[model samples]
Target chain A: MDIILSNSSDQPFYQQIKSQIKQAILRGTLREGELLPSIRNLANELQVSVLTIRRVYSELESEGFISSHTGRGTFVSTIDSELIRESMRHLVEQDLQKVIQDAKAYDISQAEIIDMIRVLFEEDL
Target chain B: MSTVLTVKQLQKSFGSFELHDISFDIPKGCITGLIGVDGSGKSTLIKCLISLIRRDSGQVEFWGMSIDDAEQEIKNRVGLVMEGNNFYDNLTLHETKELIENAYPNWNEMIFQKYWGCRDYHYSSRTLLSSLSQKEKLIFSISLALAHNTDLLILDEPFCGFDPVDCSEILVMLREYIQDENHSILISSPSGMEISSIVDSFIMLDDGELVFHMDKDHLLESHMLIKGATSLLGNIPVSEFIKLDIGNYGFTGICNDYNKIKPYCADLDLTVERTNIADIMMAYMWRRGNVI
Candidate 1:
């Protein structure tokens, strides 16, 4: 797994790494049961504190995205299909929320917006 | 977290200068940066901890062994790299290496050899100590410390004379050294910006007293520099600021918890940015009219 960090970005280092890893896992770039780098190894690679990486690993573990075994190492968890579908729905909901807000500002009715979505969806297909 | 070294109510006095009731723990697998300006008793505190200078009162413990009772044993497991080069000038690097090797029973010749050739250092053991530049001497000192199987490394302003490239190399070396969860480091420096990126936590000292001891991430996340027109200051709780400076054109303040005043910043059109260790240090220094 590759992670890049930016000191100039507003997000803290830990958050950046955590989000990137989560995105990778969700996108299926990281497969289930795939081993993650050791905390020390990842910390060295990122030039971040070991504690920061530990926090990321612990949080990801708690969120059910990963799991750790003693004397072994961290690995991506086998996420439920429902969780993945829910996450995908959540992402669309966020984007659609913005689109609805924009449509409402333009005085577009809900039926009209639905019609436009249907037309665009069919065109893309 | 397990503590590698604990200093309890450590006190020392030198004429008008004194470190009053200094206390803190060096947690294992972490790099604790001791940040304070010059004359802040950083060196004095380090001396007392290393027993280079005796403390007036306090308990210094390493792995639960008091320094008073097991000074040699504790020293053996602790690596020290201070500012000055105490090795004899007449001695060649090889000669000094032999002396240090004989002193520590756990000394590893491989580690010593690896350090000199590590990164871009390319240091030779055949050079004379008197001929080495200040930067080279500092590197040599650190190399000596890491040569032993030490659990904790104590560095006092080790980057003072180093160039930026040299500093980064040393930082990487130190980071690699602490990969083992049992190892730790305590480093002292006048400038926080130099070590801010690598330190896990910061112990800030001002006028011989610890101003605050906090995790680096927590400090960075919470503290912010708020700037806006002087008139906008009236709309917010001015008392919440740790340090405030009012100017004719505008006002600038350091907020200990930016989240508390974040709403005001958004509503009042105040410019709020993440504050760094250097900014916090400057505000504290100027709080009492110190030009440092």
Candidate 2:
């Protein structure tokens, strides 16, 4: 898998790593049961600390997107379709909330904001 | 986490300079950096850790074994690379390597030969170490570390005299060495910006005390630089900013905890910028003197 990091970005480094891996898994770029990079290897590759990578793996495992074997290594887990859908819905809901907030800030009416969303939704299909 | 080395309440004194009750762990599989300005006890602490200068008091342990019990084992397993030529000034590179070969039982002739040909290093073996430049000296020192089958590497001020490219070259080499979870490294340097990108955790020192220690991500996430008009300072709590500085144009300072002041920042329409390692350490330094 490929990953990119920016030191100057506002986001924390660990969060950047976690999100990139999650996105890759969700987008089907990474296959289930595929062995992931060892914590030290990944840390070296990214020029980050092994602790940070360990935290990333732990977070992924807790989210059920990956799992680790004691002596072997970490691997992607079989993801649930329901979880994928729920995660996507949650992301979109957050975006929609921001859109609503911006609309309200710009003095747009609730009905007008809903109408705009409807138009955008139809266009997306 | 499995700790490779633990220094508990390590203390040392030399007239006016004293390292006061410093304790930290070098966990396996991680690169830990000690950052402090000159005379901040970075070198003293490292000297004590390696037993070059005995600590006045405190316990140093490796693999749960005390220093007294594991001195030989620790010497065998831990490699030290300082940016200086403590070897005989007249000895050639090959001669020096030959002398130290028996000291490290696991030393490989082939591994030594591999690093001997580093690009632009000209470690042709016949060249005397005393004639080498600062950068070459450091490269040779680190190459020696790599040649041994050491699990833990200790470095002190290895980035002092080098171009940016050379500094990065050293950083990359160190990173590649710890690709396995069995190895660890502890490095000390005054230039936080140079090694901060590669270090997993950071320990900050000022005067003789450890001002703070933190994970890289946590340090960046916890604090931020807050800037606004000096007049706006009245709206926020005096204690909110760790080291507040006011200017005629405006005011700029650091908020110690971004999470705690996020709502306060929002309520006052203030901007909180992400803190860099250098700035974070500087903020603490400012707090110590309580003046900027």
Candidate 3:
């Protein structure tokens, strides 16, 4: 699914895979109930250990982003629209928290922080 | 995830050295590095894998079928590059490519062209193999091997003639080749120091015996090179060691439990250093005697 690994990244390889899959699902690139490649296939495609891919799939499944059916294959789990929105909001809040912490650490004024947020929000938009 | 290659009690006897009761798994899509020093039965074991030489007594399986039964299927999937350029001396690079292209069903002409394009290696498909430099010959062989689209690439000392830049380039290519994960590589090389970083696991042979078959990380974690006063060596517990070598400076060894050895060494006021792969190999080969 066009996922690439960064050896220098703080996130482990499996986490990188999980995060990319989640992003793909959120972006509608990976449709709900779409079958994902088997652990072995994915591992082979990514040139990583099957154990690494297994960890990624397990974590994604546990997080309710995917589901696995024995012999059928792993598929992107269907999520309620409300739940998807809530999860996306939570992710954004977590990112905002980091920004707030950085702002405080930098001794930025509330106005400066607001201005920075506005610029970032506009750029993202 | 089926076993592509399995060797059960595989024994191969040379004039002076013999591989004794060798057994291992080469799982589908996994690159297993066959590591050993010169004349340590790496070549002998590979010959047995390829069925070039007769094994004393053992089972060899390739792709769910016995090696003897499925010779053609195994040969189709397997691509081998040994030390020397075994190509016809009179054949140019182009002729060599055409020859190998006709042999393998899955040969990719575009991929072959791309490989040549990526490197500054300009040899006339017509340039005779004898005219090419050693490095060029090795590169040509590798290019041809990769073009075969074999599921398994068994490379024996493919890096022999490569300089650092060329070696790195080859490593990059190998890394990309294994992207299919279904494609596995069984590489036997004395130059373990170069490829060890890229390999998934190591199969170390010593004195015609399987010394270790485990992940590279685990081997590094398990072994240590403890150096201290020669008197402190005796003070440390010897039972925990697999092998030990007393050097002029101090001593180094492969220990089963590094934690246990660390405490014992600490008690004796000795420092334990993290052992390199070469040191661990040397310790096992020399059986605790001075290797260097």
Candidate 4:
């Protein structure tokens, strides 16, 4: 599990960690039942406050991406296929939203964007 | 929330200098940074908290026990790491270790050996305290403190003389020490920016007075750095800002709360950026009109 944080990013540090871990779980890179690093260990590795790591872990647990056991430590949760598909779609929608905003700033029409997407999709196929 | 140490109306005076009604808590399992400029009474507060010097008034409790009531018990569990002047220069490391071992009954030889033998601090026991570098001495002091199984650490400007690399090494050791939820640290520094990332909260002092105690997340989130035309700031009340600098070219200022200033910025073109601890410190100082 690799997490890279950018200091210049507008996103808060805890939010950055939470999103990266969520993406890893959705992509199947972190398998279900895989024991995650201890919160303190992760905090030390990232050079962030232990409280920040605790917040990230608790938020992830609440969101159904992970769960913790009393002395056994935290582990990734078994995510359903439908949830994974939904999350993937959400991620794509976020990227598309950024592209749409940029296009509007440059005064590009929706039809032109659809045409460009069609060309790019066919080229990949 | 459980607190490791609690201070109430802690007051101390040295001739004309004084700490006025200083009070705060060191929460369990959190790193709290004491931020203040020179002569801000940070050192005096730490001294009073640890019972190094007598406080003129107020109550300080460590785990609910005052130093006068449980001096031995408190000394056993609390660690003190000052920048310099604690150790004897004429003694070898081995001799000093022996003295510390006798002072603290709970000292663990194994823990001391682990840190003393680590790659970053491979100082031999035969090395004299006077010959070791400042960083090495600091490492040794901290290692000894850890060996005694201290639950709370009070550090006074421990990062004063180190370069960035050496300073980070100290930070890494501190983070490792704080892994256990029972341990807590209260570190003081004039430069708050250096330790901003690791501190869970901040206790800011200005000229022997308590300025504010705030959580790190809220402190950084609520304040903002605004820069734009000086003419645009004419409408905004002066009381809204802690520091407002008006230059011939434009203006830059620090607002206490971004939400309150949002309405004023509707027609005024301004560049608003998130603030760091240093900027916040400067803003508070500028508000007090103490820029020295």
Candidate 5:
């Protein structure tokens, strides 16, 4: 997987790493139980401090997105789809909220917004 | 957290040039970069660290043991890549390894072979050092450093003239080595940005004086650069900025106290920009030189 870090991001370096890995897990780009690159290796690849990678690993472990075995290295944690579905739905809700806000600002009614969503869903098929 | 090497109040003089109170620590398992222009006492500090030149006064500690107490033992474990790639000009790859093997008790032929032949370096055992490419010479020097059971690898611009691929190879190898808990590296280069991604932290030496020392990530977070009219700076305190470049059109300055200045920026005719290590180094090096 390609993990690109941008200097322009306001997020702290470690936080950026955590979010990327979490997104990967949620999207299934990183499979359950798949071995992750060693922390030092990732740190070296990203040109970041080892401590930063360590912080990312620890935070990911705490959130159940990843797991680590001493000396054996880190791996993506096996996750329940119910939790991932909830996360994915929340993400969709955020996008829908933005669209609804914009539509309301344009004086579009709730019925019109619902009809637009229906049309968009049909277009996807 | 354990310090592998540290210099405290290190002072040395050579009639015309002097190193004044140079001090810092290289922690175990961390890569600490030294940055300064040439002749900025970087080589002198490395020599002092290895005790090649005697210091007038100050303490040099190796793994928490006094230098005098462990100098000989320490020499065996500290690997050095000094100027000139210093291998005998006509010696073959094997011949050079044979030479380094005598000085280091832990020198392993197997270790040398791993980095040597397996890393895309195809060579005849009789191939002379002078015949190898510049990149090849650097790899050879580092292979010796790695093979000798060296705990601390000290590099001084060994990759200066190397190609991008070779430089990245060197960085990757060093990081891989440091992944082993007992190894650490202290590397120095005139251009800090070249190794910013590779180094865990850095110490900047300016004309023989320690100017800045910090972890790389924190360095990025602690400061920001803003480009705008020079008149804007007149309203801000001079001390607010660590470096500046002023010109006819405007000025671009790095402010360490970025958070404090953020509120004031909203009303100013300027844009605050995210910065990288290279930009930071340039501003510091040219902080007060020719304007703009």
Candidate 6:
């Protein structure tokens, strides 16, 4: 999997790693059951400490993005459609709430906000 | 974690200088920083690690297998970038990458592109190493090292001669590489000011001998710069110090217990400052009379 880090960015190192792996999975760049480079190999390749890498892997594993087998190495987990849809729906709802809150704070009516969003979609199209 | 590299009683002598009784394990997936002065044998230890130079006496194991038995396999898994541009001057950046790619079994092109973009190394693959600027040369070398995707990256002064932007970019790349948990880095550089904060642990060498091997936090907490009048120096017990340097204004030393000495120093009206890695290294070297 391709990963990049930004030291100057506010994001922690592990989060950068997690997001990259997550993006790869979402983009289908990393296939289910594709074995990742071992933690030591990744650490050495990246010239970083193992502890940092271990934390990333543990985080990924805990999130069900990857699974590790004893002596076998880590692999991207099989995609669970239901889980993915549920997570995506939750995220969209949260984002929608933020949009509504922003609209209210700006003194924009719901109909105006909806009209603006429709115009944005038309521009994109 | 499995042991990637181990050295026991590793003794290497270069005329007057020798790395004595150096024993350490580079646990799998850990970045181990070898910190020392120019002549303190950091390079010698790295050379020994790669078997570029023969050691007088020592045992080395790579991946739990003896180095003697698995030299080729071990070398295959170990990526090394020493001081200077080790690549051929005539070869283009692309040529260098091709050469390394052919040698290593696990070279990854996608990761190479990502690191290249992250480092902002914009040279075309065909750009000759001879034509590149010094900073470009360093970035190219780093890219080639990461592209190979080795189990361990042994870098000597990887950040030398780069501007702040380039240095920061390289640090980001290094952090990303270690995120995979299978990689580890062993880097030695005289300019530890920038990268010390990110390093996991430090191994300090003095006069070709291992002086200190400890985590960064412990080193910062344990060592101190004790400043007091020259007369107060005699009153302070010598047993509390690991090494001491007496200056005209005051003295600085590596103390075993900072708390124990704090009260005595307070009574003596002396000032104490917590030591940083650089200061501790300087004082330690000064005590050893290695600094000139």
Highest TM-score model number: 2
lDDT of 1 by residue, B43-71 (tens): 99899997999999999999989999999
lDDT of 2 by residue, B26-79 (tens): 788888889988889898888788788889999999888887777888887888
By summed lDDT, which 10 consecutive residues of candidate 1 chain B come out lowest? Answer: B117-126
Return the lDDT, model 1, position B33. Answer: 92
Which candidate should be chosen as best, given DockQ against the real structure? Answer: 2
Sort all candidates by TM-score, best to worst.
2, 1, 4, 5, 3, 6
Q: Model 6 over residues B9-123: C-alpha lDDT tens digits?
A: 9998777788898998887766677888788888888888778898888899988888788888888777788998677999876787778889888888876777666544566
User: lDDT scores for all predictions?
Assistant: 0.84, 0.81, 0.76, 0.84, 0.81, 0.76
Worst 10 residues of 4 chain B by lDDT: B116-125
User: Tens digit of lDDT per residue, candidate 5, span A2-109?
Assistant: 788877775668878877888888988999999999876788888898778888899889877788998788999888788788777977897899899899779999
For model 3, how does the per-residue alpha-carbon lDDT over B55-110 read when each residue is reduced to its tens digit? 88888988878888988788878888887768999877677778999998888877
Model 5 chain B worst lDDT window (10 residues): B283-292
Task: Quote the lDDT for A105 in model 4.
Answer: 80
Candidate 1 regions with alpha-carbon error over 4 angstroms: A1-11, A91-125, B117-126, B288-292
**Taking the candidates one at a time, how many backbone clashes does each contain?**
0, 0, 4, 0, 0, 18
lDDT of 4 by residue, A10-124 (tens): 5667989999999989877899999999876787678666667889999999878899998899999988788788878989999999999899989999999999999999999
**B1-292: candidate 4 lDDT, tens digit per residue:** 5988889998888888989998888889888999998899888888888788999999989888887799799989988887574989999988988899999989988878776656435566677889888888898898888788889988899888679899888888888788787898899899687787678888999989999888776677567778888877777765678888889999888889777786776457677778788879978987888874
Model 1, B83: alpha-carbon shift in Å?
A: 0.8
* Candidate 1: residue B62 lDDT (0-100): 91
Against the true two-chain complex, what DockQ does each candidate achieve? 0.43, 0.63, 0.07, 0.36, 0.55, 0.09
Model 4: how far is B83 from its true place, Å? 3.2
- Give the share of true interchain contacts found in each model: 0.38, 0.69, 0.03, 0.38, 0.75, 0.19
Candidate 4 displacement at residue B144 in angstroms:
1.6
Residue A95 error, candidate 4, Å: 4.2
Report iRMS values in order. Answer: 2.4, 2.1, 5.8, 2.5, 1.4, 7.3
